[model samples]
Target: MTKELLLAAFIISVGLCVAGAGTHFYQWRLRQQAMLRYDGATVFASMGNLVMSFFCGPYIMLQMGWSQEGGASVNMGSALLSALVAFGWAFLTGLLIVGLYVAVRS
Candidate 1:
């Protein structure tokens, strides 16, 4: 069970990181074409937060598990909740990136 959980965590984190890197790279391309703009720090910070989130996600899910009520099986809700929280955090970081882009372009 523990090994399965560790595997899930590793897969989820790495998957999110890969997806984030791709998204950021696409955004960078758009900025290059003048479709968007942000100072380097903002763009880098946004990307950095994704990396940080990738590392932090599983710890958070497992932490929530401690208080959850799934006796013989994992509570899918906790996983979903953790995913939402993590993505919410990432969304907030994205907002900062958007604000920076607007600040520069406007």
Candidate 2:
């Protein structure tokens, strides 16, 4: 592949990895907060977090317009937006998984 194509792929790959890691980190933070009120279900949460982070990555990248970036910026605003969206997606997915679990268990 040409250098430019390789460079573009590298940037987008880095961005997606960062977004996934950010989401996973957010999940850890949520677990910490949840621990304050209640305990247990760590395994479930971890599994759900993994699934959410893996599945939500593409959506997050699309949200960041990684494909359509036309050479996107490495600026703070873009980075922040990407992280924010990733965290939000992860959080929402976690909630959904928990809710489903509760509903089924009841």
Candidate 3:
């Protein structure tokens, strides 16, 4: 991989992470305002979602064959498909983590 590719990946990954973190923080703040109990499950679910999104987005891009050139060589259709897959994966991963936590707590 060229420096360009590496830089692109890094920028994409960091952007995703920051966005995810911001969303998590907003949710937490909302919960706090509601006087809801802040527990491990809440933290785990939020963090899980962020992590899933952060990694999966770029992964989808890569899996779709997106390269440094950013052109037809990399199938645009495949990129969309990979993005959809990543979306599902991220949602399911968050749900799965919550389920496991509930099971263990019970």
- Name the runs in model 3 displaced over 4 angstroms: 1-65, 68-74
Per-residue lDDT over 32-69 for candidate 1, one digit per residue giving the tens place of the 0 to 100 score: 32112223568786665555444344344334544557
lDDT of 3 by residue, 4-33 (tens): 766555554454444445445645765532
Q: State the local distance difference test value for candidate 3.
A: 0.49
Off by over 4 Å in 1: 1-19, 22-74
lDDT of 1: 0.52
Q: Ranking by lDDT, best first?
A: 2, 1, 3
| Lowest-sum lDDT 10-residue window in model 3 | 31-40
Show how many residue pairs clash in every candidate, following the order shown: 0, 0, 0
Lowest lDDT sum, 10 consecutive residues, model 2, at: 31-40
lDDT, each prediction: 0.52, 0.53, 0.49
Q: Residue by residue across 17-106, what tens digits does model 2's lDDT show?
A: 555565556558676311112223797866765655455564454455333444555556666676667555544554554556679999
lDDT of 2: 0.53
